[model samples]
Target chain A: MEKKNTQQEIEEEIKSKGKDNIIKKIFSWILKNVKFLLIPASRLEELSIRQIEYEKKISKRKFIRRMKSTLTIFGMLLIFFIVTIAVFAPWFSPYTFDVLVGIAPGNYDPPSPAHLLGQGRLGRDILGRIIYGARASLTIALPSILFSLIFGVIFGVIAGFYGGWADSIIMRIMDILLAFPGLILAMVFIAMWGQHMEYIMLAYGIIGVPYYSRLIRSSVVQSRDLPYVQAAKVTGAGNWRIMFKHILPNCIQPVIISFTFDIGGIILSLAGLAFLGFSDPQLIEWGNDIADARLHLYEAPWGAFWPGFMILLAVLGFMLLGDGLRDALDPRLRNIYGAKKKKRKKGKKEENDSYEKK
Target chain B: MTLIEEKTEDSDRDPEVILSVRNLRTYYPVLGGLFRRKIAEVKAVDGVTFNLYNKETLGLVGESGCGKTTIGNTILNLVSAKSGEIYYKGVRIDNNFTNDLRKKIQMVFQDPDASLNPRWKIVNIIGEPLRILERMKKTREIRKRVLELLETVSMKMEHLDRYPHEFSGGQKQRIIIARALACNPEIIILDEPTSALDVSVQAQILNLLKDLQRKFNLSLLFITHDLSVVQHVADRIAVMYLGKFVETGTIEEVFYNPTHPYTRALLSARPTFDPTTKTSRVILEGDVPSPINPPSGCPFHPRCPKYLEQGKSMACSEDVPKKIHLGGEHYIWCNQTK
Candidate 1:
């Protein structure tokens, strides 16, 4: 049976792509040959789905066992609302992000049907600016966090896998970077390079590296000694394969959990930097809206209020989502809320099944 | 320091030595405080010497810290030897041996769950060695070889798509052994391969290992603390204590006519199946001493029964004992034998 299976596999693999373009043929061939790489990844995805199902079952039995708790539901709705506004901002508002509405610059308008949420000090539509502001905040925070995570994991894996002099040097550099407060260091980078959206993002990305690297390093140190890694070494794998293939995959869980929380924090800080004029003045961000309303504090309090409210809502949604992820991912907290007796019986049944299968 | 003469089972056949070690020592430094000063040293595998012959299973039995695992790791060069010489088929392997040697010497770790990569499917985990050492490219060929190996370990082809976590401990161990046998290695170091397994499954794995070894003529360095388990699988036994080999002999010599006091204690500790036989348990006086600051002269002298029986003589504390041959390959490190 095994022989026939292998024969069928070989035949399928060797099948030709008829009359295709040279590039198309090459792409198909590359894709076919890369089956070895794809199978493991697909299997990994399948295993992770099993893991998520297991976690869902555990978390359901424990605290707030519902598939979607009230808090999670609210958070999801808020995120959905924000994303909708960002995606269809033009449809929601009569004016563009920077264009004036109701009146010219240096004028303020209160809530009205034609221009809801009133007008900014520049007479631009507050609702439109707020919608576009969500786009800007999300784009900056997500990419910067991604940049930091990629670089952090690389440095951390290298430092953790090849200890001794390499670990010492990499950790020492991280220490020096960590010594300065992240926000202040980001401000320093903004000061060095003229203040712009990209520079602010670059600064945030640089500052985020040490935090993630340190997090990844600690986890890596614990996992590097696991017998699987030792087994990989015994198989004659080099340092690169051991670090990337074996160690990095296991170190990603805690990093992902931290990344969720860090995204909220980065959004808050990005708004703060813009408020402090570290970002380009021309960019229509929530922080820029609040900064513009500073002179009209008493006359147009609603100008700052709308933008401030959106920032609060966005940060709260992310924080709630982060908390939910932590609860789901952490095993100790996983089995806390459902009927203890029922869950224990189920667990016992599963254990027996595993035993019987063996 | 005169070397003890080693005897093979069939001396007339000009027995081939697959692996040999000379004065092997591995010490770890203990760093203290800021500036990282060398505060102390851990003599994990201090001055161990032995040889493994072709197609023979050499069991290394010892207590937890006696460095049995360390010796196994050192042989595979996983843990670097501080000062020693290792020869594989009379070819010296130092820090810079060619990668092909890795295919010749594979290892099966103790804990099956920890040994197999949890994120990987059975195919990748087992085919990894073939990919690295043999540089086999085609996925079909790798999959076919993986299936054959799994079958050798008594697993089916359907298991190829499953992840490590999906399998039971015994099945995971089968995958690990399959991985070790992937390159068709000449020698495999089974480092307590069955310690973490259930009693029934342990037997199954041992039998599988024996069958594969016989089929491939593979030499095995079986390291374990359980004497009974090793007895079933090992052809020769080396009794270790406090990071040194105290007794070396064939299974019959070690079990029937045990030489070293440590060996006797280890044997007595094994619970006999026939409980009505009424055998006296030779429990030692104290624990195995710390390897950091071992006893002067003889490392085992502090806990040695013979030393206590002889009134703790000054000679036992002052001088190291020489290796004394009993019969065949049996040798003991004791002053009485000398």
Candidate 2:
């Protein structure tokens, strides 16, 4: 009875004051529903329990099953190995990449006890340079790919969602960017911005935007007219909200699969740029080491071989991871695998039942 | 108490018309050539008009590409009408729908799989309308309201945090219904809501729709290609052929005395289980003509059985048919029958 009287009083107060002041009315309504504003302890416990159950269910989903493939595990291990080497480069490397240990003509020494992976033309320890090179390669590639993804998704969603003059204009611009060979475009960007590491990364990043944008654009276009998007519109969601919140999540799987592949591709391209003498000579990059070893390839093949091998390993690891991710992320493929597993289990159960009857 | 009595008396005397559509037309342009010029226009919806009374289910039935879905979309403003006026409770809302108007009107789309965002949980999907239209910011309030809606649709609490893919087709439709009911919408446009479900599930959904209608006094614009489903739920029926409505009447009037030849052919197309009764099926010859270059005069004249029976007269080929009133609230557009 007391609670009812207080509620009625608050309601009456709001009715009298709300006619003149909207803010005061809102405040009074909030006060009236204060219990709802601060959730009760019982509700909090229930929500936490629900969340834990949800997480447990999610972990056992098809994606997890697909991730358990042998090749995917190998790819993950390979990436972990490279990342560990990169992180511990300073502690692990026996000599600085820039230091020349051997004297004069003997600087181009073969593989020895002192320098495990032989020496470059400049007599720098190949293993030490390769370890440090992992850091430089990742720093450039990861951030650049992320940059491309952000801008590409923005442009693609806008072009595909609005889809009229905006679609034509943005897509044509992307087409123009794609018309230029990727290397040539990167070179042009590097030319304009100078040969600094940041400029090189920016060039690589910009060169990649067209591919990501086109990929996201096609997916966005296909999903934009889907009934769910229309339902969101009918529910009074704005164009921006519909694009980012509803449509983007559905169309982003292809973009995610493409992202992993592009990391390796960008790393290779950076090495190519270095090989073409666009990179700084002072930098202890894999591509720079390979470039330095090119002259001594005939006498000591190990110099060029080590750096080339590291690039190959890095690229192969990323490619394998990308392939695995593509298979895992595709719901159709995941379901197919799941069905096969179920069928096998059913077959085994039937065989066991028959054996017991026999 | 007197105000409530007076409102009931008013309603008893005359049924209130909640939504009125006047001469609605929606066209899609086909672009071609180097410069992407508008080559031709597909008349998806050409001049459709109808009124939906409060607390009544108005079923809009048609064959594929006959503008049934287009009409629903035009009312929702998802598709811009080429020329039309849509008045919601006497105020025109075709191109000018306020947030309040939007809150009162919602849609349940066809294809349970396609209608839901596969990525979203049932709670978020059902709570979306409340968050957007009502500005209900508190999570607890929204969840409580969502729970109420789920119960209204007969869905369980365990389905809340699960994704759409986790549910069967029927359950997904129920969740969609819960989403549509989140804001307590006065009118719901159901575009073939059960064409994708099994027959048993279809019957269950129809019963749920009927129950929800009585509970909330909702005006439903149920669009479907299936006539039996329409017969089970609709209070009134509008039969569409090509891009125009061929007939509109109460369910008994339309079902019992289908005046228009197109409506008769459509009614006769419904399959019957009784083998003893020999019913002459009105098989529509040829196919629905392309809406891009629809025949002159009556759009249905090309394949209309009456037109063929009357020797393909020039009158049927040259003049557009006018509406003929066959007594109270029942009318059809057919020159030959009149």
Question: Could you estimate the TM-score for every candidate?
Answer: 0.80, 0.82
> What is the per-residue lDDT of model 1 for residues A59-177, given as tens digits with 9 covering 90 to 100?
45443453255566677778788888877877876786557323455467887886788878757778787888888877788788888888888999889878889999998998887
- Expressed as tens digits, the lDDT of each residue in A199-311 for candidate 2 is 77777777778888888888899999999999999999999999999998778878877888788778777778877768776667777777777887899898889878877
Q: Tens-digit lDDT track for model 1 on B50-85?
A: 888999999999989889898888888888888877
The residue pairs found clashing in candidate 1 are A61-A337, A61-A338, A62-A336, A62-A337, A62-A338, A63-A337
Question: What C-alpha lDDT do the candidate models reach, one value each?
Answer: 0.79, 0.82
Look at candidate 2 and tell me the lDDT of residue A107.
65
> Candidate 1: lDDT over CA atoms?
0.79
RMSD of 2: 10.5
lDDT of candidate model 2 versus the reference: 0.82
Q: Candidate 1: which stretches are off by over 4 Å? A: A1-93, A97-108, A291-358, B1-15, B311-315
Top of the candidates by lDDT: 2
Where is the poorest 10-residue window by lDDT in model 1 chain A?
A329-338
In order, the interface RMSDs are: 5.3, 2.5
